[model samples]
Target chain A: MKALEQKILTDGIVLSDTILKVDTFLNHQMDPLLMKQIGEEFAARFQHKEITKVLTIESSGIAPAIMAALQLEVPMIFARKRKSLTLQDGLLTSNVYSFTKQEETEISVAKKFLTEDDHILIIDDFLANGQAALGLLHIVEQAGATAAGIGIVIEKAFQDGGERLRERGIQVESLARIESLQDGKVQFVKETRRVEV
Target chain B: MKALEQKILTDGIVLSDTILKVDTFLNHQMDPLLMKQIGEEFAARFQHKEITKVLTIESSGIAPAIMAALQLEVPMIFARKRKSLTLQDGLLTSNVYSFTKQEETEISVAKKFLTEDDHILIIDDFLANGQAALGLLHIVEQAGATAAGIGIVIEKAFQDGGERLRERGIQVESLARIESLQDGKVQFVKETRRVEV
Candidate 1:
């Protein structure tokens, strides 16, 4: 988390008070070194739980989810986002509203992937509105699977998504929680200790 | 490769003559252990090359790219597919036509992530028409970077993607090459030897 926060300070570009673009190292372009470490952190955090699988959304979330799945020694299932929903046979689908994109998208997973016997750990790159996570949760619930906890790389604490999930008594752990991004500067909810380069 | 071939034989579903869905393991619900092996195989194949980075497209390509990057000990960059083209100053963008989806999507990477000195190895889940790889190759060319080679998990030999890349003198290594999928039965280009289960 210290490395992540420091990387955010050095490489993360704050485009606005509400937008932080980590395309340099997090989302579009990823640092596998940091991603592997992030996965280890999640594995350590949920070491006590019975995590049968790691669930995430497509595109951005797959990076960290793959790393976490490697550390946890579990398979990962990513729900694919569809522009339009059609059939209802083998797919377990849910509709999610993206606050950043300001659009609604449908996400789905094959019903065969999840079952009542599985315990899932949800992982994502950013948790601003928590819509993606909630959608994944819906898929997990539809399969009668249990969600052990949620692991997020960065959480916009200023947003109500993380708080909303916590209010529901869902265990959520974000590696780095941003209190705000005002004045084109990122402020974390908890200050990080000085780290050696 | 044998393991991968065996996996394909067991889990891969032939949705049609042209479409073989491995979402149960390769894409949607991923098997990390198999993916790790696939990555190791990619590393072994390209071990002689100086691969500074691993390049891939977003969504399905992220999983194998992550594994190959982890095995190669390099950074991985996934070109995000955007429905629209925005500012192109800080990005290297290309338009790719998806034969499956029958649409044109814009894919881009931050200009800073790729450089002239970088040697990139392209990784993807499936090579159908090779449009995605070609788009990525264009990005590498735009960056003045050299493509070391390409590593594909599965190749639809019936399609011209692999043949096209080879015709262009691009090095391509596919884990499993399918001869055809007739009558819902999959056949490999090269017969795999008997393996220990």
Candidate 2:
């Protein structure tokens, strides 16, 4: 994850102590080559789980998840976000509260896409409070599918989301983990050197 | 485009005369291999344009756009959709009306991502009413960027979007052009066999 960490240092904008904007090459505008590499890295890391599908939230997660799915030779499914729930049938739904947006949104996936036979790898762009990952995990559980692991591009380690999932014994792998973003500087965790760049 | 056409006939659900649900592989639950093929197809079609960037709207458009960008070795930018505009500066914004959802959503891109020297290839999942394409074209124009061409996965030729763009002398390449969707059957435009699968 050295390239990603380096890109964050070079292009990432520190909007505030709690907000890091990587619109240049991560989310709003993206680098397809970097995304492909990120996907390869995720696939390499989770290749042992025998993943049948890649699951992620809409918009941001689709890029890496699609690429990883391609590398893993599996299907990729993005859970759709809805502002209002209409009580649809044959849909697995979960509620997520975004601390950044300060709003509650419902995420859903078609039940036919997931089954007891599938092992899913959940992927996302940012893991701050881990609400989005939790919501995706909930949908995966509802379908009777096994969550192989969670792949995150960037994780705010100062927050409790990553720790919460780890506490549940869920395998969480974040490519870039931020130790702190205080004083307009991004501080990555120094001790964990096992993750490849 | 035979593979795409065949996939549409096999997995695509023709909901009505105007709506075709391709969530099985094109949007919601996507096949990565098919999507990779789609990206390659788009890249081949627009290879002669010297495209500096690939552009598209968020969510559905990201998959194809990213793949095309990867093949083309360029950056991809997805316009962010906003239900309510916050009047932000340094953004190229346009209004797009979704005929399916029957709502007006403002789409915007960061000003720095696009430039006058850039030759952009606009990619999208569908070309139904062409409102989304029009909005993207407007943003390109605002940035003083030249649009090399527009690449669409499926074009509802029964609709007026394709005609409108062609009327403006824009080079539009649609992988699958539908002649009709009558009696719950998907009918592709028969004459244009120039597009390779």
- What are the per-model DockQ values? 0.56, 0.61
Steric overlap count per candidate: 0, 4
Best by DockQ: 2
Q: Is the docking of candidate 2 incorrect, acceptable, medium or high quality?
A: medium
Q: Which candidate wins on lDDT?
A: 2
lDDT of 2 by residue, B1-197 (tens): 88899999999988789988898899788988888888999999889989999999988999999999999999999998863222256889999999877789999998999999999999999998999999999999999999899999999999999988877877899989999999999999986643332
* Model 2, residue B62: C-alpha shift (Å): 0.3
* lDDT minimum window of 10 residues, candidate 1 chain B: B188-197
Question: For residue B25, what is the lDDT in candidate 2?
Answer: 91
Clashing pairs in 2: A1-A196, A1-A197, B1-B196, B1-B197
For candidate 2 chain B, the 10 contiguous residues with the lowest summed lDDT are: B80-89
lDDT of 2 by residue, A99-172 (tens): 77678888999899999999999999999999999999999999999999999999999999988877777778
